[model samples]
Target: MTQIAEAVIDENGQIPLMEPLHVIGPHRALVTVLDEPPAGWDETLMAAEKALADDWLRPEEDEAWAHLQ
Candidate 1:
């Protein structure tokens, strides 16, 4: 049986499982660390901020799209 759980490691290099194992006495497990955010996070935010900074609703732009409004 395979089980997956998320845990944080303490300063003493120990991670406490949130739940008990169903299988009996001794078992082997694998631990992986996910310490970084997803890729392109900063770039996505910067692009969004740049888009908001543009004058998309200016008088000229508004008139151009007045039919839609």
Candidate 2:
């Protein structure tokens, strides 16, 4: 299994993790430095809303979930 943890790299090369990484033993890891700030949840969802609406608006999609209603 693979484990992922978010962290911030400092100017002096220090990394402070945002959360605990549960795992055993030592292992090598990869670090990607993003130049741009990550997008907000609202922006991320709205960006996909149009694409997803293409399928979600279909009558078949509503029928599939009609049982729940």
lDDT of 1 by residue, 26-63 (tens): 88999988876436667888988867667674688889
lDDT of candidate 2 over 13-51, digit per residue (tens): 898888998778998888888776444747988889999
Estimate the overall C-alpha local distance difference test score of candidate 2: 0.83
Those runs of model 1 whose alpha carbons end farther than 4 Å from true positions after fitting are 37-69
Q: What is the TM-score of each candidate against the true structure?
A: 0.43, 0.47
Candidate 2 wrong stretches, greater than 4 Å:
37-69
Report the Cα lDDT for candidate 1: 0.76
Instruction: State candidate 1's TM-score.
Output: 0.43
Clash number for candidate 2: 0
